[model samples]
Target: MNMDIKEIDGACHCGTVRLRVRLSDGLNSARRCTCSYCRMKGAVAVSADLGGVDVLSGADALAIYQFNTMSAKHYFCSKCGIYTHHKRRSNPNQYGVNAAILAGVSPFDFAAVPVMDGINHPSDHAGGPRVVGTLRFVASPGE
Candidate 1:
C-alpha cells in the first residue's frame, strides 16, 4: 500500500499525554495480537521506524509499566491511566503506537492487518507473525 510520510498528532483519553510522531510509510501496516494484555486492552499496534516517534507533550506525565519478561515498557498517562504506546521487547528500535490513542482515526478491520502470536512471544524473533496493514489519519474538524 502506498502511504505518505508525515507528522501525526496523538494523545491519551484525557489528553494528558500528547505526542508527535514522524509517521513512516509502513505505519499503515498494523498488527493485531491475541496476547493476554493486548486482548484485554484491545490495542491495535503499528510500528514506527527507529527514532520516528516523538513525545511532544506531557513527557513528565507519562508512567511506564512492565511485566512478565519485562522487556516491553507500556507507557500510559499517569493522570488518566490510559495506555498510549509502548516499546516492544521483541524490537527495541521500534515503538508500538496504540491506534486508539491517535485522534481522528476510525475503527479498522483486524483481518486487514497481520496477526501476531504475542502469547508465546518468541525469544529470538525467528518465527513470529508479521504485520501487514496501513494506518490512515484524518484531521479532526477544526483541528
Candidate 2:
C-alpha cells in the first residue's frame, strides 16, 4: 500500500457514525492482536494518537465496550454493531482505528499483517510487546 496517506475519513456500516483520524504512522503501523477480545473481533488496526481521532457525526450513536482490565475502550456503531476504533490498552496514548473502516482501505489491502501478542500484554508482562505471527491474505485464482 502507499503508506503515504496520513488522514482518513471513515464510517460504520450503518453510516450513522462517522469519524476522521490522522494516522500516527500512516498505514505502516497497521497490525492485529491475539487477545481473546481482539481474536474474536478480528480487525486490522492502524495507529492514531488519542487526539488524532474525531467524531465527525453521530457521536451519540457510538457505543463503547470495555472488559477485563478495562484500560482499552473499544468504540462501535450501536446501530450497525461495527467496530470502529479502540483506545489501545498496549499504549494508552494511542488509539487503534479499524483499518477496514478507513475510506479506500481494507484488511485485504495488506498481504500480511503482524500479529501482536496481546494474550501476554506488555502491561501484564515484564518484557515488551511481541509479534506472535503474521496474518496473510492469499487471493483466489480469479476475481
Candidate 3:
C-alpha cells in the first residue's frame, strides 16, 4: 500500500491471472472514468505504459473485450470473470490496470477519486477531458 511503489504484482479474484506491473505514476495515476463501459465495469484504474505490464501466469485464461471504437482492449480472467487490465483508448500507449487487483490495494484506498468526463470523450471533441465529479470514500468509526 506504499504510494512510493513503482512496481507491483497483481492477480484476479481467483488468482487465475497474474501480472507484474510497472506503474507510470505510482498510485497517483489512479482514476475513474464516466464512459459507458468504464462506468459499469467500476474499477479504479491506474496508468501503466504499454510495456509496463507482464502477464506472469495464466495468460491463456485472459479474455479480451472490445466495444464501440474498439480502441481499448479490456482483459479479464476468463475463469473467474474478473477484470484485470485494459489497453487505454484515450492513450493507446498506456494500459489501465485495475487498482483493486494490485496487492494491498482497494477501491476505497483513495479519499476521493476524480471522475473523468468520458461521456464526452476528448477524442470526440476539441476540448480535453474534464472532471465531471468526485467519488469519495468515508470510512466508518470502527471496522
Candidate 4:
C-alpha cells in the first residue's frame, strides 16, 4: 500500500507547545532510548536530519531543560511540563521530535521501529549512526 505522508501539526496537551513535522514513512520507525530521562518519560523519539522540524508558536512558552552530560537540550512546555522535543547532545544541529507529540500519526507499527542504544550513546554518536540512518529535511520558518 502506498500511503501519502504530509506535514502534520502538533502540540502539547495544554497547547503551550506547538510543532510542525513531516511524518516518517512507516510505523514504529521511531527510536526508543533507555537513557535515564528517556526511560522516565517513555518518549518515542523520531528525528529529522538537522532541519526537519518547525516550531510554529510558543518559543517563549517552551522551556529548555538540560541534565547529565549537558549535551541534549530537552524542550518542554513550561505550563504543562509535556516534553515536546529535544536536540541531540551528539548533534546539536538535529532536532528529535517526540513521536507522541505528533497528532494523527499512527503507532500501529511502533514495535517495528528500531530501538537505538542511547544508553551507551557517544559510541553510537561517534560512529555517525544518528546522521546515517534518517532522512534529513529542510528547516521551515520556526525551526
Model 1 C-alpha lDDT per residue in residues 44-116, reported as the tens digit of each score: 7777766877888899999999888888888999999888888887778778888667666534533355667
Q: Model 2: which ten-residue window has the lowest total lDDT?
A: 1-10
**Candidate 3 lDDT over residue span 35-94, tens digit each:** 999999999999999999999999999999999999889999999999999998788899
Q: Assess the local accuracy of residue 66 in candidate 3 as a C-alpha lDDT between 0 and 100.
A: 96
Give all TM-scores, in the order shown: 0.78, 0.97, 0.97, 0.73
Q: Candidates sorted by TM-score, descending order?
A: 2, 3, 1, 4
- Better by lDDT, candidate 3 or 2: 2
lDDT of 3 at 130: 82
Better of 2 and 4 by lDDT: 2
Candidate 4, residue 45: how far the Cα is off, in Å: 1.0
Tens digit of per-residue lDDT, candidate 2, span 45-141: 9999999999999899999999999999999999999999999888999999999999999999999999999999999988889999999999999
Which TM-score value belongs to model 4? 0.73
Off by over 4 Å in 4: 1-6, 23-29, 106-109, 123-143
The candidate that achieves the highest TM-score relative to the unseen native structure: 2
Predicted structure 4: lDDT: 0.68
Off by over 4 Å in 2: none
Among these predicted structures, which one has the highest lDDT?
2
lDDT of 2 at 118: 95
- Alpha-carbon error at 111 in model 1, in Å? 6.6
